[model samples]
Target chain A: MAPMSFAGKTIELDADGNLANRGDWSDDLARELAAQDGIAELTPQHWAVINFMRTVFEKDGDAPSIRRLTKESGVDTKMLYALFPKGPAKRAAKIAGLPKPKGCI
Target chain B: MTQTAEPIQKVSIIVSRGSLEGVYPGLIMANGARMEGIEASLFFTFFGLDAIIKKRMNSLKVATVGNPGMHMPTILGAIPGMSAFATSMMKKEIEKLDIPPIGEFITMIHDAGCEIYACKATVDMFHLKKDDFCEEVDGVISVGQFYEKAAGAQIIFT
Candidate 1:
């Protein structure tokens, strides 16, 4: 139940969407994540973007816009959808180890 | 406590053919991953092995009529000159999307940092050497080594 980093906090996944890293959360975001299923992976591409998104968040604590993401990674947009099969921003975000994105559903 | 999870940030795809149909999926996926900000890899093996063959990778073809679609693969095969027609059609569709030809796309993806692998066993099976492959390949690897790299990441057989 302890936070993974130097910070001392624990994220519990028992709730619908308890973040795996509560230390990474803002209070409001933590509560929101708790309201959904923890996180799910329906395909390989989901895992692909989720991993990349985590890196961006780690560097900035904020999710990159899709355009920024493409520019940064140099991958095409259509392919992201091909992998996710579920919407990219909405679904891939959860598995990527990020807080609920601001203004994102 | 939430599950103790590992963080993953990159992806690898395996491409083993130089043919139009066999190689494009891996290239498309690699490019797609790059677009998503994920590091993508393509490992080429066997006849798919041709996808990385420096001279042949770019010249792959769609199997037209005799492909698994039952009636199509053979019917297309029966037509004397239809193979070229099918290849051109495939090329047109890909061009419409602006996807480069198989060779160029592979090069682009590799330059974008998509790790490309040429299987050693397959190379031996086909009697090829590293120089026989395109520059995109990072190294020749065994299936075991491939597993080591692919462990925490997605393993796409395409």
Candidate 2:
């Protein structure tokens, strides 16, 4: 695990680089995380997914799998990949300050 | 720095059986690979082509007879409509887990950028044309081409 500093506040990250403390997450931190994944800007579609993931995790204590995300996140599978390339579920969860999804699908 | 094992970058899965149990493992593996940021491709051949065929893809049945996993006596398994019954039960369980149906799963994995291919020999033997398959199929390729695509990647046969 490593600590990253943003706006003079130190934030801890898990070994997978996901935010270690969910309470430490902020919109600015999300933008910085997305930028590290090569997304220069977070669009509305990205927030749609991030917001959905956080809402689900808040209620369920686990992030939704990609299949669930596609079905209920108001975003389709193809566009999810386009918006968060190379593993949308894993990437989006990381940016949303949630743990890695556990399901295989 | 500690030395780390090399991650799998790509996988080429070969689906050679048409049974509901046979085809699903390969599909799940291929889809799982793509979800982990690994490249994946599925090559359907022999009876496995039924998984991608337009007319049969959605109607695949579980094999009750001769399948030891069914946990039933062979004679009981041979009873009429047993396979359909088993397949329906299995589909229900899968749906409860929120897994998509086969046809929709194929489209989802393809939409996620996993390549899907049909075996040329199997397609020709079955007299299947390009249009005979679901639109997600990338193309029909020979074993040689499949190997070429499998180069530098792990290959899984199901």
Candidate 3:
């Protein structure tokens, strides 16, 4: 695990850079993490996905897969890719402060 | 001897088992590889061909024999309906998580740009036709063709 510095506060990140503790996550943290991943800012659509992912993770105890994301998040597959690029589920989970999504590969 | 490093950009997965648990690991790996921006190809042969056969793909079973996960004595595993019970149990669990059925997963993998190939030798031996396969199957190819296509890619047999 590595430490991420934001607002003079040190936060822990998993080896893959996801938040080490979901309870430590906040909206500002997500914004910082998203920017770290190269996104300039989080848009409303991005918030929709981030919130949806966090909600699902809180209930399911695991991040949702891309299949589940598209089917349940109200965000279609194409837009998901466009919004997150590269790997949507993985990026979204990281930004949402959840564990890496299952079945991402 | 020093080995030169060559970036791996693709993975070739060979699926030769027919059980539900056996078939899924390959799909999971292939899907994972693709998510990492790597190209993935799944070559199905022998009993693995059941994964692409429309009528059988959704009906794959978990083998109780030799499966420590079964948690039952090996002799009891030979009882009829045990496989069906196991399959149904697995299916229910998967469905609860909203995972797509095997057929849909195959299509999803293909749509994700992973090439799905049927082994020609097995196709001939089983007298299977293209129509017998699910739409996700790109084509049937000989072992030589698969070898050529798999050239330079990491090969995994499951």
Give the CAPRI rating of model 3. acceptable
lDDT of 3 at B3: 50
lDDT of 1 by residue, A9-97 (tens): 44454232425553565533423432343433344444446557777788878666554555565555556545543344544565554
Each candidate's root-mean-square deviation in Å? 10.9, 1.6, 4.2
Q: Best candidate per lDDT, number? A: 2
The numbered model that scores best in TM-score is 2
Q: What is the C-alpha lDDT profile of model 2 across B56-109, one tens digit per residue?
A: 999999999999999999999999999999999999998887778899999999
Model 3, range B1-158, lDDT digits (tens) per residue?
22587656899999999999889889888877766657789999999999999999988999988899889999989899998898899989877766678898887777667899999999999999999999889899999999999998999999
Model 1 complex DockQ against the native: 0.04
Off by over 4 Å in 3: A1-12, A20-47, A76-85, A102-105, B1-9, B64-75, B96-98
What's each prediction's clash count? 21, 0, 2
The sequence of per-residue lDDT tens digits that candidate 2 reaches over residues A18-88 is 88899999999999999999999999999999999999999989888788999898999889989988688
Docking class of predicted structure 1: incorrect
Indicate the worst ten consecutive residues by lDDT in candidate 1 chain A.
A30-39
- In model 1, where do residues sit more than 4 Å from their true spots? A1-105, B1-8, B70-73
